[model samples]
Target: MFLAWNEIKRNKLKFSLIIGVLVMISYLLFLLSGLASGLMNMNREGIDKWQADAIVLNKDANQTVEQSLFNKEDVSNSLKKQTTLKQSGVIISNGTHEENALLFGVTDKSFLVPKMIEGKKFHKDNEVIADESLKDKGFKLGDKLSLSQSDEKLKIVGFSESAKYNASPVLFSNNNTIQKLNPSLSSDKTNAVVVKDANWQKKSLPNNLEAIKIENFIKNLPGYQAQNLTLNFMIIFLLVISATVIGIFLYVITLQKTNLFGVLKAQGFTNGYLAKVVLSQTFIIALIGTLIGLILTIITSAFLPSVVPIKFSIVTLTIYGVVLIAVSLIGSLFSILTIRKVDPLKAIG
Candidate 1:
């Protein structure tokens, strides 16, 4: 350990350069991970909050919620089988504030409606709840918001933190109001029903009806699977890049001190002691780089928009940090092998 520290101190320029490379790699990876998570959040934040067990869609639509249809009789029939049903629909419209918006029509029983961050849930006829982020676009409670797509006017009664399916602020409304706005929909039937059962059998479902768990259903959406796959690949690629950069840096540093390590071995130093030194140096450098990378990620994330959709928990960040440390330890093993090839006699001359 002492020898490793002395060597690093003597080669300050080389060590600093190696450490700088590690810092840059770690920083870039952290940024990519945050962006990937943010993109996914923006794409699915609205649907993710619904604590639903399963969603029913039209079998012919092949997993698209928008294409699924439910008449009142079909919906009522499905509700009788021990599952609560909520009518919901998504319609693109121009908001009163003149922004392109997506209206989320959901009944009072809809699970998504109860997550009110401000104001109240959907009530009163023709009244709707908007996402709080839309307030900056000139929306206010009691103000009339128009759905130009259907030429319907709705009263904004409340606002919440829920964003749209694709970053647009969502407007919550009841089934009747949604049907009235878009008369093509039968008021009796619902778009989908959230089911709560582990033993759900899709085979038993009647023809043209499909039951899917939320996770499976989410992937079936047109761009959902492709988008998630792209982000996941980006995160994995960055992680690999970070590991490779750290490994190369350590390997180069170890190669430069081959003769010095050979002399140390002749002077009664055990390989184990030498290993301790190498590991200590690697760990110290890696810890510093990882810490700096995480700090930079947090600082940058602060300036992003609320609707940009980045969801991360303490557990996720902790796991990422652990993975970084583990990869660095694995990378140090390459240098340990170099120590075995040191010829003590060669250095004595």
Candidate 2:
């Protein structure tokens, strides 16, 4: 390690280039991870707000809440106490301006409604509380927003934070309001029944309905699985490339220092001693590169606009940082093996 430290200090610019490559790879990995996490949250923000124990969906709907339909009376009969929801995708218009929104129908006492950031929560059907993003689109409290393809108009009674679903702003109202907006969903048919029973996940019920864990339900949300799959693949690919590049960089440096290693070997430097030189250099480079990368990611997120889906989770970032450094060290094994093959006399000749 002493020899390794001396060489790195003497050739700072060359080592800097090695660190630069890792910095870029690690930056991309962390940035993508943050974006992936952020986008997943955006997809199920409202669902998470519920802190729901389980969701009971129609068996024929294949676990998708949006597709599942149940009659309130039927669900009411099966579960002693439950909150019913009717979700529909629709457009809201203020005549000149329109925005895509999810219309959510919940009973008067349903706990699915998020705490308000401003104004008051809806206490009746057709009166609604919306995600604050709608305010940016020129909506204000007490404004009437019309439902597309229907005569129904929803009054924006309040604004809530982080109440989006599938990346769309939600209009939280009662079951009758949503039923008015979507013809397919009649007044009697709600999309799903939500219950907080402790053993609901394993509960057997009638009416072709079954309860599922909320985590599983969120994972199955439309577009959630596929989008995460693509981003995760990119993260994994960058990790592999990072390891390979770090290994190659260290290996090339080892080649240029072959004669130096040979001279040290002639002076009775053990193979074990030479190996530590490479290992120590590898650890230092990995640590510095990942730190710089994580910092850059945080700085980049700070400058990004609100609309960009990027959220930094220190825990997730730390996990990735550890992984990057571990793999980089594993990669250094290649250069360590190269050091073992160094010959004293033949190389110094």
Candidate 3:
């Protein structure tokens, strides 16, 4: 181990170059991971906050919250237990204060409505809870904002953070509010229904209504699964690339030190001890690189708003750390093979 440390210290430039490559790869992996997770959050953050146990949609809707529609009466009749009305649609931008947004029309009983970051929830006529990011877009509490592609206006009553789906800020209002804007909408129905009961099963649901756990229901949302899969693939690809690069770098380092390892073997050092030395070095370098990259990610994320949709949970960090270390350890294994190949007789020459 002392010999390995001295070798590394003596070849500072070479060791530094190897560590530098690892750092760059680590940084790229971390950045890509953040972007992928961010994109997913932008698409599903609102639903995640709903706290609903189940979501009900029309069986024929084929994984689209937008396509599912159930009248207030249909939902009422379908409800064998606790349930709430939920309406959702994209907001298209026209001219004026009317901008593009995603609308979520819910009844007073809906759990999807976010708790206020400022004022109150929907109560009186024209009342709406809006995303805080929309305030700069010419919306304010007590001011009227029109939904684009429609002539009707809803009054903003409060503000919330993030509150988005499919990368658009979400606005919450009552079904009556949406009815006034979209006359073509069913006079009595909602986009979907969410339930908190645990006993819900698909076969037990009323005909034409499909019951799904909230997580499963989100997967059933149009484009949700595809988008998530694509982003996840990108993240996985980046991690793989990082591992390959680090492994190649370590392998080259090990190859260059083969003769030195032969000399060490001649001096009575066992292959096992030499392997530990190389493995320890690889781990130390990887740990430093990962820590630095993660710190940078957090700093960059701090400047971004909730609307940006990037979130790093403890679980994500733990998994990332585990994967990175595992990759580094794999890279270190190359040196072990090189250590085994050392011929003490060749060094005696």
Candidate 4:
């Protein structure tokens, strides 16, 4: 470690360049990771709020809530405890601005009802709870929103944060409101049934219903699986490419120090001690660079536009940082092998 510190200090420019490369790679990775998480949140954050173990959709709906609809009889009989939900996309306007909203028709006692960040829950047929994003578009508690292209009106009674479906803000209301908005829907039908526990088996469900694990349900959501796959592949590719680049850079620099290492060995330093210096230097550089990169990411997140989708998870970032450092150490092993092969007398003579 002492030799490692001395070498870094004596060759500040070279080590600094290595650290700079690491920071850039780490920054890019963190940014991509954050975006992937955020996009997923945009697609399915509303479902996550339910915290349900699984959902039952019509086997014929092809795992899509939009295409699934069934009467409440079987779900009520098959599961002792469950919540039924009816969802549809509707255009809403605050009289001045129009936007698409995924309207959910949930009973007051249903677990699908999220706690409000402001105001009270919807208890009346026409009262509603909307995602907080609506506030940016001139919405306020008690404001009346009209179902665009129709005469139906709903009053916003509350706001919930990050409640979205299919990248659109979610609106919560009673079945009556949704029924009033879309009279084509049958009175007793629900698009999905949510179960709080994973107790029920697939064979036990109604002949028309299929049980879908929460993860599978989310992944099956239209466009979500593809988006997640693409971003994940990019993130993986970035890590591999960055690791290789770092390894090659370190390998070249180590080769440059062949004479110095040979001199140290001639003075009676053991290969084990020399190997420790190489690893210690790698760890230090990776740690410092990763930390700086994380800081930059945090700062960059603060300045990002609201339109940008990103979520920074402390746990995720910490894991990535550890992986980067570990890989750096592993890469240094090649350099360690080089140190081991250095001929003391041949080089120093």
Task: Tell me each candidate's TM-score.
Answer: 0.86, 0.94, 0.88, 0.92
Q: C-alpha displacement of 123 in model 1, angstroms?
A: 3.7
What would the per-residue lDDT of candidate 1 be over residues 219-316, giving only the tens digit for each residue?
Answer: 66567667778877876776777677777788887888788888889998888888889888888777877787778767867786654556555566
Top-down TM-score ranking: 2, 4, 3, 1
Candidate 1 Cα outliers beyond 4 Å, as residue runs: 75-96, 136-138, 202-204
Backbone collisions counted per model:
3, 0, 2, 0
Top candidate (TM-score): 2
What are the runs in model 2 whose C-alpha is more than 4 Å off?
95-97, 136-138, 183-187
The better-scoring model by TM-score among 3 and 4 is: 4
TM-score, cand. 4 = 0.92
Model 1 TM-score relative to the real fold: 0.86
* Residue 207 C-alpha lDDT in model 3: 83
Candidate 3 lDDT over 1-349, as tens digits, reads 5665677788888777767776676666666667677777777788888777777788888756777776646556545455455455646332455556777767676667766787788886557888776775666777766554566767778898756776677888777776666554555666677776666663365688787788877675667778778877876776777667777877888787777788888888898888888887877777777777777777877797645556677578767866887787786786688779878787556
**Candidate 4 wrong stretches, greater than 4 Å:** 136-138
Give the alpha-carbon lDDT of every model.
Answer: 0.69, 0.85, 0.71, 0.85
Of the pair 3 and 4, which is ahead by lDDT? Answer: 4
Candidate 3 local lDDT, residue 58:
83
Compose the digit string of candidate 4's lDDT tens values, residues 1-349: 8878888999999999999999998898899889999999999888898888889999999998878888877778777568888888888888777888889888888888766799989888889999887776678888888876568788999997767777888899888888776665556888988888767564387678898988888888889989999999998887777678778878899889888888988888899998888889999899999999999999999999776879999999998899888877877787888888889877776
